[model samples]
Target: MIQTILLKQRPTGRPKISDFEFITEESDLTLKKDEMLLETVYVSVDPYLRGRMSDAKSYVDPFKINKPIYSGSIAKVIASKHNKFNEGDYVSGMLDWKTKQISNGNGLIKVDATKAPLSAYLGVLGMTGLTAYLGLTEIGQPKTGETLVVSGAAGAVGSIVGQIGKILGLNVIGIAGTDEKVNMITSEFGFDHGINYNSSTNMNAAIKKVATSGVDIYFDNVGGPISDAVLFNINKFARMIICGAISVYNNTELPQSVSVQPFLIKNSALMQGFIISNFSEKFPEAINQLATWLADGKLTYTETIVEGFENIPKAFIDLFDGKNKGKMIVRI
Candidate 1:
């Protein structure tokens, strides 16, 4: 039987495990021509998934109630009637939160386990990495010697953005929720400096202390107060890449925070918000560059893997708690 988790109820504030329900069904192993059966190997637990939990209008349609939640997953093709994918081929795609999945194999991409760990396709070498790449280069338009500050700096996209900034010879300052994350960003990811937002009483002052020259590029994954602080430190003509707003995703009411328009006008800066699919046309190019960087040892990544399929909901809820240091993945 295939077991799956379904969104049982819409959550208010931070999500709880009670908001999800588990069910089992007779395993659907039947495959028609051009169809494949996949066994989930790794399920991604990301901040963006939080927004999808609501019925609100967004870039992607909200997950329907009583249906299995879906996100990117790395799976092994256990059975296949498709010519493109043979049994034992590993693939990555937007799949359900079930142990077993049946697909027509339309969006699945074949992945090589030898080139990188199968799970890396769910993270660094996949959508997360592409988000950082296209967002930074295409939107932020970073240049050499500029100062870059990234919110949610210890997370999947922010960590990669900071590392890529370093590779581009920019000074990188990161903002994370914990001292541990702050330390990891500077020591492990080669960021220039990291601020512990949880410990700082005056975020603006703290950022000013380190970024004395003001920020030239801000890669923001967390919005709200942290973004307000970053906005106050922007240099003239600075660029802001608005990624995930993890801080306000769980809010039931309209989220309010310090305004950014004044700073945008005063500095003649640019702040652009984007969904990664905005650059879907160039994914092949982005993936090739990220894989090359990984092979060349010019880039590094991290994952906080939770074991077991049943714990998928817990893994996702932990994202709001800042429990993972990097990309959070459920290893089934």
Candidate 2:
């Protein structure tokens, strides 16, 4: 029997651990011509999961009732019924949140832990990694000596974005929800400056103080009032990349949309929002660069790991509440 976590119903507010049920399932060796049984090691819980909860039009489908929830997970092929993944091979792919998963070997890809940590394949070196790379590279387009601002600055994707901006010769100012988060971002993630949104008496003043002149590139993760504050300091021709809005993820009603349209008109700013899935063609390049950086110590990642199958929903809830430091994951 394998322990698994399954979605029960659409949640209206904060998702408790009980929102997801931990149950046992029978395992079978029955295989198609090409298949494998994978043992999950780490499962990523992201803000994107909240979007999947609503029965709204989006990139992915809503989680069906009674179905096991699946997300990007790092796993090892324990028993192979397929030629693609042999037994004992490490891989990272979308897998059910459980002890073991049976797959037909389609989207699964081999993970090279000799180059980076296995858990990294679920975070900085995975889909979230790709999203950070693509959104910044394609939209942010920071130049030398330019000022860059990253919201949710201590997160899996935001931290990487800020690090990359520093590498590209930009002064990176990050906005996080807490003081500890601010400390980690500047001390650990190589950001030039960091602001704690929660403590800022006047957020606009705090942003203008750290960013000095103005923000040249904005990599936004937690949008809302924080974004509005940054939007007030945008430099001419500034670029903003909207990836995930962790701030509004748990809101029952539509969030109050701020009129930043004026910033675009005033600064000639280019603000483009993107879903990571749109960059499929660029995954290989992203993975290689992220892996190289990880091995070279130029990139670092932190994960808030919750052990056991039943805690998946709580891990997700923590993400929106900013209770997590970096990538939020469930260890199975």
Candidate 3:
């Protein structure tokens, strides 16, 4: 039998286990010409998937009720009838949350387990890395010696952003929710400084103290008051890469924060929000660079791997509670 997870209903504020339904059916294990059987190996659970759970229009269509919920996943080809793929090959792409499934090999790409771990393709060497590199270089336009601050600095994308900033000669400061995350960003990821937002009573003052020269670039992942605090210390011509707003993703009503208009006016700053798909043309370049950095030991990544296919929804929900550091992956 094959097990699959479906969207039982659109979530009401934060997502709950009740919003997801698990179904099991007899396995077919059959494939037509130009098709292959894929057994899911790794599943990526991201905060942005929360946005898709809502019915509102956005960059991507919402997840339909009672339909399989898909995200970036790595799967192994156990059997194949396709000429382009062979049995025992592994591939990475957006895939359904099923224990096994069949595909015609359209968007999927073959991945080498020897080059990097299968899970890394869903993280540092994949979309998470691309978002960090393109969003920082293309949008942030970081220069050497300038200060770069990253919100959610310990996360999948933000962690890579901070490391790339350091590699590019920027003074990097990271903001995380816990003391341990703060320590990990600095001690493990080579960030120059780290701040625990949960412990800081005066975020504005804290930011101003550490970022004494003002922030030249801001990589925002969790946006809300933390981003508002960053506004007080931006340099003239500062660039803000508005990535995932995990902080407000589950808000029941409109989220309010300090006005950014005045900050931009006074600083002549630039704030741009982007979806990684918009920069698909530059993906090859981004992936090559990220791989180079990893091979040179200039880059590293972390993953919190959950052990069961049945726990995928819970692992995703844990993202909102900051339960995982770096990428959250379900290894089945």
Which candidate ranks first by TM-score, i.e. highest? Answer: 3
Model 3 gets an lDDT of: 0.95
Candidate 2 per-residue lDDT over residues 1-332, each given as its tens digit: 89877887777766666667778968775766788888888889888887787664543688876788889988988888787789899998888878887888778899877877788888888887888888988788767999989999988889889888877888999999888999999999889898988888899899998888799899999888998898999999999998888777767787897698888999999888888887899888888887788778888888888987667777787887777878888887
lDDT (Cα, tens digit) per residue for candidate 3, span 1-332: 89999999989899999999999999777899999999999999999999999975653678988999999999999999999999999999999999999999989999999999999999999889999999999999988999999999999999999999999999999999999999999999999999999999999999999999999999999999999999999999999999989999999898999989999999999999968999999999889999999999999999999999999999999999999999999998
Q: Could you estimate the TM-score for every candidate?
A: 0.98, 0.95, 0.98
**lDDT for each of the candidates?**
0.92, 0.84, 0.95
Clashing pairs in 2: none
Candidate number of the best lDDT: 3
Displacement of the residue 164 alpha carbon in candidate 1, Å: 0.4
Q: What is the C-alpha lDDT profile of model 1 across 1-332, one tens digit per residue?
A: 99999999877789999999999999758899999999999999899888888865663678878999999999999999999999999999999999998899988899999999988898889999999999999988888999999999999889999999998899999999898999999999999999999999999999999998899999989899999999889999999999889999998888998777888899999988879987999899999999999999989999999999989999999898899978999999
Better of 1 and 3 by lDDT: 3
Error of 3 at 151 (Å): 0.5
For model 2, the run of ten residues with the poorest summed lDDT = 51-60
Candidate 2 achieves a global lDDT of 0.84
